[model samples]
Target chain A: MSKTVLSTRGLRKTYGKRDSKFDALRGIAIDIHQGESVAIIGKSGSGKSTLMHLLALLDKPSRGEITLHNHPTANLKARQLNTIRNKEFGFVFQSFFMNSNDTVLNNVILPLKIAGVGYRERRRRAISALKTVGLDDKRNNKANDLSGGQKQRVCIARAIVNDPKIIFADEPTGNLDSATGEKIIDLLFRLNQEKGITLIIVTHDHELAAKCSRQINIKDGRIVADSANETLEAENDDKEEFKDNDMDDMLDHQHPTHHINVDEEEE
Target chain B: MRMLDVIYDANANLLRNKLRSFLTILAIFIGSFSIISTSAIQAGVNDFIDSQVDSYGGEGYLAVVSNDSFDALDGLQNGMGNNKTPIEYNPDKIQTGMSPLTNEQIEKIKKIDGIDGDSLAKEQTLDITYVTSEETDKKYLIAAEALPPGNVKVSLVTGKQLNLQADEYQILLEEKYVNALGYDNDNIIDKKVQLAVKDDYTHKIKTFAAKVVGVIAPSVVSMGYQYTNNKLADDIYQENIKYYPEDMKNKTYAVAVNYDYENYSADEIKDKLEEIGLSAMTVEDIIGTIKSFFDIILTVFRIFGYIALLAAAIGIINTLFMAVQERTREIGLDKALGMSSKRVFLSFSLEAIMLGFWGSVFGIILSVIIGNIANAVFHAPGGFLESFPTFHLVVYTMSDIISVTILIIIIAFLAGTLPARRAARKNPIDALRYE
Candidate 1:
């Protein structure tokens, strides 16, 4: 019953000339509802990363339309896109594109800073986000000084620092070993389950796609399959149950006997 | 981020390239130093000239002379009289063809609207003697001027001034003359000395005795015994009463007129004197000849200072260019981070201005230190840097300092603009990709 959080129709990105042109994204259409963990899987140059960039507003689509939280992004100015990027969406890159000179805490707080959040409030939110990723103790470590797994965790922490509506992660664990990559995947799922944030991840690993509630497989810049996994669906139901219980408890504490009477009078 | 953060970042970045920054600053410093030091020296020189001029009476005074021949009654003619007779003159009667200016001429000049005061004086070349114990006689030809005791151009070390109204019984001696006589006595105000006067008609050398009532020291002693002997003397003597005659009044010459500009200019005064059949000149004419000599010397010094400044400007340009090259990456990063082209330009220009300001400050301090050291070594006085033996070190006034500061800033800003614009126009993508 919740609103659809993201939708795209005939999205296309073409690079180069007509004679030797390349389609990074060719007529992609998808809709993501609230609180969904969707994984996009493809081989190298399959346009998974291009689609992620379009979804994140980091790049403009050469053709077609994208609507996020019901706001059309196709005709948005660069500054408006930047504001949307800052306020509505967060990104985690596989290369861990954090400023090398900044510490883990500073990197995590950067999005908030660009959003013009107050310093103390930014620090508090960044620390909370780092705690969610279990990297609170490593806040002072430089991005380059951390191991592959820790750097990815820092990136995850930075993505969730602003409590954005959606997180678009590109090859989130492509560089890490199996064990570290698994830990990163678990962290992403935990943020999704606990915060109810919409998670859209691009990955090459089929196992990672199977772990999400929905999987969209791309081949040559075109989505070939969109399927829901039974196990992921069951886990999502359990998460919905916990959320409903928490909401009931919150309503009880804040507004008991929540019933409204409508008064209708003829004038 | 706060502006302070931006400034601090800039300062830190500049500090990382210490040697380059220092060189840039030095260039600015040298340029400002040249300008300030030269101005200070010029100011000191002007002050010296003004003092010298004031000491030689005042700026408004003019000394007038006559072009016509002299006659007997002409010499004694007081300008206050109404006798407008133009005497037919003989050139031979005129002493050296420089016809003596009469008291009448002085009074006539004084009657002019602008004329404030005037003095008529007569100078004669005569042999004077002092009898040491009546046997040892010291003989010297002295140029003696008969001025009103108050009108003498020399200061007296001792003794009373000669009474000009008292015929020739009194005389004022030069300080050197008194010292040379070895009079040894402290009070020689009433001492008698003899002066030889050649009679105009008889052509006989008559010795006349007069009392030494005063002593005088000329500011400049030319054609005096001191000029030859390099020793001071008291030689000025009053004429004796016995030899003084009515006919000798034709010897009068030299009139100095003091005037104010409220009524007439120097040219007007000169013209008025010419109307009365006398020639005249102004003090400015004499000063102009003297200043022309000094102008050449100052011009040479100023040219040298200017050359030094040109070299410093070249150094500044070089430093700024180097800085632009070094900060290319940083400029690109700023542009990528949403910095406007104008802001980037302002930042770079501000950095240049800061460099210039610091350079000028350091250069001025260095110049002052060096000037003072030179002054201490050479006993220089009264200039900003005090480098001369008689002038102090050249100190800049507040206005001078402000002007130099603004000039350095302007130069720095101008120097930075070209490089900044070049950096700003760079494509953001290309700049970000630069290693």
Candidate 2:
């Protein structure tokens, strides 16, 4: 078994004071192993989004602890939390929050820029990330000029540009039609399988969750069910078929040689 | 995040709102402009004061006179000394007055080590009339006055300065007299002039022949008065007042003292002269009061500039506050992307600082152009601005320019602190949820 990359124990979150007190997340526990694509499924306000935010270190949990690769992260200062976010985690939002004024290339390069990466390397990696999303041809176009699917593609490029070890996607395809949603979901899975990067997604779509290796159902911030899908079961039996030719063109950022396969994929 | 990235992002964001940025910069521009112009005016006033003092042959010496008789020196002059006006002094009245400086007083003044020299301020009555070369008929009476030579700045037309200790009878013609006395051309310096005074001891009119040694140019503070050393003064004083009534005999001299200004400050010398039961006057005594008055004006004028600067600072705060409110989501996005709150704070503050810096630069450039134009308008030969107290109406000092720039930047940085901190401390979840 691959080693566990992240886990939470008795995680709880609350808002407001005294009489106005309200709980956003109830005590719950879970372990997520590396290279596993997991889906957190829940209804709106079921605390899935809150859990995602806490796991991403975007917000502090009121109680309990979070450990990434066995390193406790519950009490890390804001600066250190930000460092972890920059170097280890990538997030794709539901709304595709791309800076409209920036070029698609610039939008992708932002995370690396924030990481204090050199300009030349950041630009090269940003271009490579854009190619991963199959939007390298539109790199110079303004972000807003792209269609919704294309904009989401730019957002995905931005997320993976820094080579984060874990990609936390919150409803990454909520705004897309089924066909576009599948294409985006397929792209995310390709990254997970090819790079051995961890993937945890929060979504309401059952079809999307059925494709993940594991599905954890949540209600009132508590896990109601946990199970592996048939695809994972079939893979364990060595009977799964991997016929996706695009995966051959998947970006190997550590070695730019794989980046050369992109042009042939367009044909 | 690196500092360069923060600034680059800030610049890119500000560029997205071109009009708002321009308007904010304009507010600071007005603030800096007012300060620079006000400082320039004060600098011009300072130059005016120096030239005014210099016109009186500088502020190095003091005048010591008996009683309040020297009051005429202050009340008699107004405006700059662009023209020479005759002095209304009667030597005999002062010489024969009850409180004239006796020999014993002169000896005591000499005893003061700081006192370089002392002379009797005397005026002489002599009939020296000449017809103008143009008219060749109508004679102009030339009134002659004498003083001890130490402080007066005399510009000669042809000949040289008079020897204050010389026994030779000599006269220095005022520039206006060169033409009024009928001597055309500038060749009157060595010309001979005739004058006759009544002899008090002999009670007979004694006529003496004197040579013109020098001619004084028109002065800015004093004019139209002929100058002669104490040697000639003694001759006229004894011949004119030696036979006056016994009580009037003591008034033949009004004692004046010239000292080293470097060794003694004006107030120190004034106090010393007053201690000897005498009144003293210097150029500074007159101009020092004027300087204080102008200083008050300068302070009051700068208050308006500071108010404008305060308003500009508020403008910066208002601009940044609105920016924080508008960019709530962007700020959240930045934090989510791994930008630390401190970096956020620094980025926003730097944007404001850059705004102020650009505003000050624009203000300085525009105001310098405007100031130079104003100066040109005032300092031109026929310009009416020159008619005002300052010949060159505006002046800029390095300190004034630098201080105004730095002060505005500081004010802007301080103004940005509130909004920057707010941006830094924003909750990422709420900010992201913001529309």
CAPRI grade, predicted model 2: medium
Tens-place lDDT digits, model 1, residues A75-194: 676566656666677677676766655589987876775565777899999999999888899899877799999999998888888788888887888899999999999999988898
- How close is every model to the real structure, measured as TM-score? 0.54, 0.75
Compared with the true structure, the alpha-carbon lDDT of candidate 2 equals 0.74
TM of chain B, each: 0.61, 0.67
Q: Point out where model 1 deviates above 4 Å.
A: A1-267, B26-29, B32-346, B380-390, B422-435
Residues forming the 10-long window of minimal summed lDDT in candidate 1 chain A? A256-265
lDDT of 2 by residue, B86-186 (tens): 44456544423235555665566666667775433432443333223333455455566664346565555467877777887777776666777667446
Instruction: For candidate 1, give the lDDT of residue A96.
Output: 70
Model 2, A68-156: lDDT tens digits are 89887865777889888988988898988778888999989888888899989999999999999999999999998998889988988
In order, what lDDT does every prediction score? 0.63, 0.74
